[model samples]
Target: MDGRAARETPVHLRLTHRGRVVFGTIGTLLTAGVLALLAALGATSASASAEQSEQSFSTVVAAPGDSLWGIAESLDPEGDPRDLVAELVTLNGMDGSGVQAGESIAVPTRYADAPGVIPAQ
Candidate 1:
């Protein structure tokens, strides 16, 4: 029939149901891929920034009569001495909270030197 022929001609020119579904699926996959890439980049950038902000350390030898509390106070006067001492104990892998005279330990360089005091190399 003439009417049936006209309808069939337009249907053939346009996309079929299967074609539309395939195109939609492809578009969703592409969008998800782009989002995943962006998330990875963002995480990398955050990690880099964290690394940069991390404090650098220098080694210091304990003197006679030096205690962990005193050393922490001298190195980081503005910070809590208890916390600094804990960090020192952890950094040097000391079995206990005790430090021997003339023992070298790693100390965070941030605020380690007071005004007019030269930082150790």
Candidate 2:
């Protein structure tokens, strides 16, 4: 034998049945918690954005020949006029679609300054 002795090799790491089960359960719980947290964050941001972009109102005055249907058509020529008329009535708390000249009416902010749409204030 030489003057130097042989060095001992390190043993490989091993897990028992119980050890494997415990580690697997911990990993699964941690993964589930992370997924849940991400989902919650995503949902919160979506709702916050929706709230921030909510519709707003502006005022317009009725012209001599202007009617609910005309205003609606001017606002969105391609879209249905009835729907917009209903919205106008609802916003201004009108009993019907009738309006007098120079009467101030509330309209959605998006359609406030469109062509033929006169702003009251």
Candidate 3:
């Protein structure tokens, strides 16, 4: 052999017997990892979107002879009755100025009207 060795092909372009097979395997693995990452991101966004569409509220309906004002007054006694009224209206699809007995309404969280709590939009 001469003092200088033969110049071999570059690693990426080499076509040795095992080079092609190994390179193909590595390429496939990298591609799979990238695709998996994309799939995870897509799933996360879809779940978040579904979450935004659905919301839950809690309220109790009044029995016959019970007054709307009384129900409003009694809900979350520690919370702001006004905000409770708003959440109730928004949740039950009731008229802003009207309420009736036997109607279910959502009560705002106790924290909703508590001091130092940020008001809901």
Per-prediction backbone clash count: 0, 0, 0
**Regions of model 3 farther than 4 Å from truth:** 1-13, 56-121
TM-score of 3: 0.36
lDDT of each: 0.78, 0.83, 0.63
Residue pairs with clashing backbones, model 3: none
Over the stretch 4-24, how does candidate 3's per-residue lDDT look in tens digits? Answer: 467765556548879888989
Of candidate 1, the 10-residue stretch with the lowest lDDT total is 111-120
| lDDT, candidate 1, 9-112, per-residue tens | 44346789999999999999999999999999999999997785464556777888888898888877788999989988987778877888988877766655
Which runs in model 2 stand beyond 4 Å of their true positions?
Answer: 1-56, 118-121
TM-score of each: 0.46, 0.48, 0.36
Instruction: Name the lDDT value of residue 74 in candidate 3.
Output: 62
The best candidate by lDDT is: 2
The residue-by-residue lDDT of candidate 2 on 9-121, one tens digit each, is 67799999999999999999999999999999999999997785464456677889889898888788998999989999987779999999999877877786787555544
Q: Is candidate 1 or 2 superior in lDDT?
A: 2
**Which sections of candidate 1 miss by over 4 Å?**
1-56, 112-121
Q: Model 1 misses residue 54 by how many Å? A: 16
